[model samples]
Target: MSEMHELFLTCPKGLEGLLADEAGVLGLAEVRQSTSAIRGRASLETAYRLCLWSRLANRVLLVVSRFAMGNADELYQGVHAVDWADHLAPSGTLAVEFSGHGSGIDNTHFGALKVKDAIVDRLRSASGERPSIDKLNPDLRVHLRLDRGQAVLSLDLSGHSLHQRGYRLQQGAAPLKENLAAAILVRAGWPRIAAEGGALADPMCGVGTFLIEAAMMAADIAPNLARERWGFSAWLGHVPALWRKLHSEAQQRAEAGLTRPPLWIRGYEADPRLIQPARNNIERAGLSAWVKVYQGEVATFEPRPDQNQKGLVVCNPPYGQRLGDEASLLYLYQNLGERLRQGCLNWQAAVFTAAPDLGKRMGIRSHKQYAFWNGALACKLLLIDVVPTQFVTGERTERSHAHEHSDTGQGTAGEHPPAPAPAAPARLSEGGQMFYNRLQKNHRQLAKWARREQVECYRVYDADMPEYAVAVDLYRYWVHVQEYAAPRSIDPEKAQARLFDALAAIPQALGVDPRHVVVKRRERQGGTRQYERQGREGRFLEVSEGGVRLLVNLGDYLDTGLFLDHRPLRLRLQQEAAGKRFLNLFCYTGTATVHAAKGGARSSTSVDLSHTYLDWARRNLSLNGFSDKHRLEQGDGLAWLEENRETFDLIFVDPPTFSNSKRMEGVFDVQRDHVRLIDLAMARLAEGGVLYFSNNFRRFVLDASLLQRYQVEEISASTRPMDFARNDKIHRAWRITAR
Candidate 1:
């Protein structure tokens, strides 16, 4: 027997056991599984076989040594102990991939640099030359992990992951990783189905990954046969004759397996440009004859006549990363479910998606679901049998279809036709009808103002009736409704019922689809909780306001990137900004600065405390083509004002009510800190300049002492727009000019 080595095989999360099973099936010894990796004892030939045959494994690593280390000095000593000559020559190029967190070694780059220094010092002493580092394609790749005080160093045997089967050269918008696709197939029980000669189909196959992978599995082809190079190809310890013999054995197996009857595999893609790439990848994988791809939509997809009776229908349809995407996907998913339930009667199906709620709209029940991660996104693979009984009834389908098609024709210039309203139940209370009537009255009054002023997003209703307590705002075709947290004395059940009534009344009275309405609770935020994400739907919509386009995220954050109450103030700044140097303090998303830029400001400066908001501000500026003469800095707003010597003719300061975020040195209270915040801002004001200060604290009171230093006028009444006429306390604005 040859020498035994400790080997570790890493895979995607949730596939650890499957990888271990693959290792055991390949005749390895002592297979064990962990959270995201598998361990076993194997000879050199066994490692080679696992790398070639195992489709789920990410990388095959050979463990060199493990020790206890805490800092950079200890890490250097530990890596220095490994023999340099045994792995590579002194002239060979190498790269170190370092990971893990430890005391005093918190950064990966510093740790990697230390590891590189130790290797070069050892090799330079032995052969009078040191290897150079190559990050892209290195001859030898070393991996080091540090946890607590323990370090495990290993060699990355697989160069660029075994999943890069060399077939997919071009990918679609959001392509699935190859290993993740393989894991999905394994969970779908593809191996067992192939053994029984069942066929396979992918209705929304992007670049033909699932279909090509399925064909290779049925033909018993090695997953990594088409790879151009491997880590061992450059190592000094590589055995050429042994690797050649194993390679020939795999070729013979693939050749004989191809002679047998192949399972019928088909792929359908909606994008025409993707069909050629899918076919090109299929040809590259040497599965051209067995796997076929065609350009077609999922609604009309059908199994071929020569295909087997019952197989697996697997697809990773578009799950919509943004708010707008989710509204459009309900119809696509419903169509897919209809096609499968009616056309492919006896087949089993697997739907992988990040939005399982959208998956539920498919009108089918999933008997089994497995959780998996596609990179950073946690996804699910749902298994269902395509039977008539699994689908929803006719009435439910009709309602779902109506919601899906309401957003059509909404992209035009003129008024869009309203979708037919659902019949109101007889049990609806008088308060609900009154709520509907108020929305209708509000829409009628605001329609003329919205069109004449060119404002698409405005407050329509603000708690008009005491019984219905919610605020509704219109952002073009979509509506956002925020319900205030009901008082504790109110019954939870009654409050919920009132809330449901308000949600139902919004769409019918406004002539908008229910799908266009989003509901959220308005609560007093603590610390930075208001800025935190409410959901992971990455949808952003473009809306017009004051003649400039701004991106509004209706799904992700509590605030839709724009404060509806400050609409008039932003327009005022735009009207007064020509030929002035402008400065925006606490610019949440740079909306004010964009307004100034569009109004022909000479130059503008924006400062904020959050990097996330700062990046958003940059995007907002660039979106309007405000390219030059605009600078955005991210830091403490007060500190920035104290350090800045530049003066501006116009400045806008809109601050949060209370903030105790970690990025700030001290807590901010609009009532307590307003004096100091304004004094510092005034020091940088240019001659004859005016500053507009605004806040959303409803009960705020301005200090009388500020009137003595500057001419202060409360313009809150004039600044409030007509949409907010019902609720005059939405925000307070002040105009202060140097006396």
Candidate 2:
């Protein structure tokens, strides 16, 4: 009988169980599983086979010696006991890796140094020369592990990690590691599906890792068949004849598998740059006959195979690591789900993502979920059976049912009664029901007024009830909710429960898709914090107010691009701006400038400190076909006004209550700076010109001296819109002209 060698197979976290099962299937004996590794005893042939065939292992280590050690000296003695001449020539190069810390060896580098000294001393005593250190491409690689007062010395047989299958040389920005991709395919049941003659597809294939792994499994090819060098390649104990026999067998099996019917496999990537690289990788794997890749988008992805063929749709969609990434990716996930439903009916799907909440927006139900780790970030694998029964079609309204039955004449007199409406959505709690009723009532009352005025965006509800302190606004078909921070006296858990209830009722009450809703926490912002981005999603939506089209970004900033309460003010500007030179100060998103231009203003100048908002303003003006005559300046409002020498017939000044933006020279307070701000604008006003001043500070008091210097009339009531009437203190406005 041949001697058995102890082996340890390391894999990615959460893949230990799968690795252990794979070891057993490979003829390893007495398999035991630990965190991210599998341990067992195997013959030399079995160990070699595992190194070639393991699709989930990172490295394969073969134990050479084990002994108890109390200190670093004892550790050196244990490694020295091994006959180094049997593994490598005295003049060959070697590398040592040490893990764990104990028995006076607290640093891994120090422990590795001690082991290296021991090995060199033993080999030098036997021969006249000693081996030198080689960190890369060493003739022999040794590993020492110190655990629980014992040391285990092993030889790294797999060398440069088994995950490096050597096919992918060019990769995308964030490519999945090869072994992790293989584990995902295995967990998705690709082996079983392939045996049943089914197809496979990846809609977002980056560099074709999943496609190549799936093709290798379906074609019965060894994962590492093309590798040139291994850790055991230079070892003296390597059995060349046995390895050639196994390699020849693997080659023949691959030939036979290729001769059989080829399974349909395809990959589609949205990035044009990655298409050629993915194709190159697939060709390098020698599976181009069975697999193909193309440059396509997820929105248009469809698997084309023989009729009546069902398969697995596997993809690792980007879940976003930065703040605003999830918001932009929401629509991507939705589009993927829509395509899957329309194109690949009855297909199985496995979607792996780091952001599980975004998965819910796909409008599908996942039957099972498995946890995995992508590097250090925890992720989930959502297993789904794509069928009609699992689609999340929102609650059906009675009107839709009536329209459907009318088309078939099924509800006519004496005919079969119309089918009952779809089942009601899950019941809301008592508090949730109350919140839902309030939202419905508010929407019913405000919707008609909004439509009559051609208003597509307005506030529907605003902290009407103290317990649910949130503001809900309607932006065409989408809803934006801002939750006010609870006071310190309130229980945090209770407040969170109330927030959940409010969120649950919003979609049903407004008749909008839940995915269209965006929520953010509202709190007091200092400095330029309000202008600071809350998310990285640069997605912007174009909305119309008055007669001009403007852009609004609800996901990026604390305040949407357009303020709902300023609708009336913007309309007034449009009504009075014809043929007049206009100047707008502190113009956010340039919505006001767009309105003035639409009102036939001869030309306009808009100024603000943020380059981002200025760019947004440019887009808004361009959207309204008024860009050539407008000027956008990026500087402090006060400084810009001081530098301007031109006169304007109409001016609007809306300053923040308090601003300490880094771009500005000094802090600005609305109450303290009002007098100086009006003076600066009054100097630039043409004869008979008008200036409108406004601010939204709850406790603001206009300087009394302003009334003495100029003829000012308060228009707070007339400028306030109906939606903002409930909050009389939303903003204070005044119309001032020269005395």
Candidate 3:
């Protein structure tokens, strides 16, 4: 090797500039950047320093030879010309990585074999015995890049990609590679943020990649300090004394860095299973004291009051690229925007996502964007300065414009409310005025909280006014109103007047367009009556909950596609679904199955008797790109469980209160067959698996003696969403596990 060798530092695409900048900072000479590699001039010491310090570099390569070649013979001659004795001993083990091809060497394997033969032939001539080949862990690693009839051979100094930082013991779903995580931090300007005494946060921190990387950068810890082995460590030319001196200096610097006030860094995760792993990774990185993680939802995540202000909030939130994934992400992005706008004012925010379109839905326009690649998937890093100017107010959103005029065709109020005291019109009678006031009050009370939670479809008014006698739900830009049937004792004309007043007042009070609102009369439903069609509007509006998009049809059926009360339960299933074989029994519309699939379930089976709903379930699964791994079976839940031979890691059973459908062998009433239903579902549960059984019978009682063999806990309180807090009797749920 020459005194000053030409070296190349490879990194993920779109991170070339940061890698080059890091090389220049490390005092490498003549730094030049490309799409995925950075080239610079470096001595042996410079190369060693970068291997230990460059967080964005994948591997450090020291160029040995470059020659023009058009065929296998020329390639062999070129590699054979280098002095094999200086870099590798004849008795040592070696491996070669051949990439790119030109001339006659069109195959990587063939090219690698040719190069290996040439190296061995040359070494045999010099020492009389060739070196052995060890692909897994060789004493020396060589890389040969062939481009346009030219080949450049180099020695792999860092051994495995430098991105392996030697700390991560375990990882969660679709984890960001360590080097890419560091590159994201560099692009987000974390070093400068730390220098300015500003804190850092990741609301969706999974496995603490971002948090640990940020902490390491802030504390000036060497990226590869903890690595016990390196490619050069076994190389014959390595200088042990020099490496030991440099390693000692790094240790002293880290010790000094640790004494400074720890950076105000924290992370929050919705999945509890990931919290301990995050702490483990942090401890392995020797940064446990500087970083902290907690179990919490994004809706409630906030920076500590004592923490520094004006920092950077970086996160790689779930980017749904599958069929049904996009629709559900709308609310998550919306909620994220709200959290940043409300809590992190003045803090710079960086969100890395594969779907830039979804980022726009956050309502906070990104000031800058940098393209990147997470493996082969193209993505972007969006930067937004969370200042007052970018805040999204209620009036500026689509929901407000939707309510400009009442869709009822009656002359009602427009988008904005009228002056405080105007003459009551015939359309809005005295009773209508009261209903309007009540809706307006509810909207004011729930809108902010709902927005914070990314809840677009929620019950805004649940019979708040006795005269109204209706339940009102806001679904994005549309309103769904279900009026309770008036009692027979009341005068018919008076009841009709009150219903008209309530309908007219909704648009005026909610500021939603009257045309988007759908009205239905609440009635008792049994068997298949609830699924029956009510109108022919043929409109399917999309709303989001727990990062899943659901199709709701207020015009087609009395009940919309979603059961709003189960939002919390669906989210919980999403959290616990990873790597599990999930079974959804009585899966109405298969919304819960979609949640489980999105949560990383290996496979899902949704069983429902209604072919119409089974088809609906298929659509929901198809919407999320989970149609293939999941199945929608049209069969009776109990019968299917009794005949099934497969055991599930997780099972959910949510049966109707009463069903006398002809598809069933007999009437299946929850109150009469509760024990049988639980046992059937539990029978399919695998070891360590759980069965979530639920029904909305309101007064249903469990057969305690029958279920005594299983461990059961009623989770109705935790399963209820914030919107359903007013009515706990909406449903009953229990988590049952085999003893």
TM-score of every prediction relative to native? 0.60, 0.78, 0.58
Question: Tens digits of per-residue lDDT for model 2 on 414-437?
Answer: 112212222123234577678988
Which consecutive 10 residues in model 1 have the weakest lDDT in total?
410-419
**Per-model RMSD to reference:** 10.4, 7.6, 19.3
Q: How much is the lDDT of residue 469 in candidate 2?
A: 92
Query: Which lDDT value does model 1 have at 187?
Result: 87
**Clashes per candidate (backbone, < 3 Å):** 4, 1, 16
- CA shift at 10, candidate 3, in angstroms? 0.5
Model 2, CA-based lDDT: 0.84
lDDT of 1 by residue, 1-739 (tens): 9988888898888888878888898867898887788888999999889888889989999888898986788889999999978998889999999888885888999999999999888887454778999887888999887766898898888888888888999788898878888888888988899889888889898899999888988999999977868977898777888888888899999998889887878887777778888888999889888887776666556764443478999999887655334334554675577677756787889999887765665667888999998877899999988877776543212121223335332111112212222322112245656787788898999999899999989999988887677889988878897778888888876776686666645666676765577777778775677787788877888888988999998878878899988988999999999999999999999999999999999999999988988888898999999968999998877889888999999999998888888888889889988988888888888999989999988889998889899889999999999999988899999998898
Off by over 4 Å in 3: 125-128, 396-739
| Cα-based lDDT for every prediction | 0.82, 0.84, 0.81
What is the Cα-based lDDT of residue 238 in candidate 1? 79
If ranked by TM-score, best first, what sequence of candidates would result? 2, 1, 3
On TM-score, the candidate that comes out on top is 2
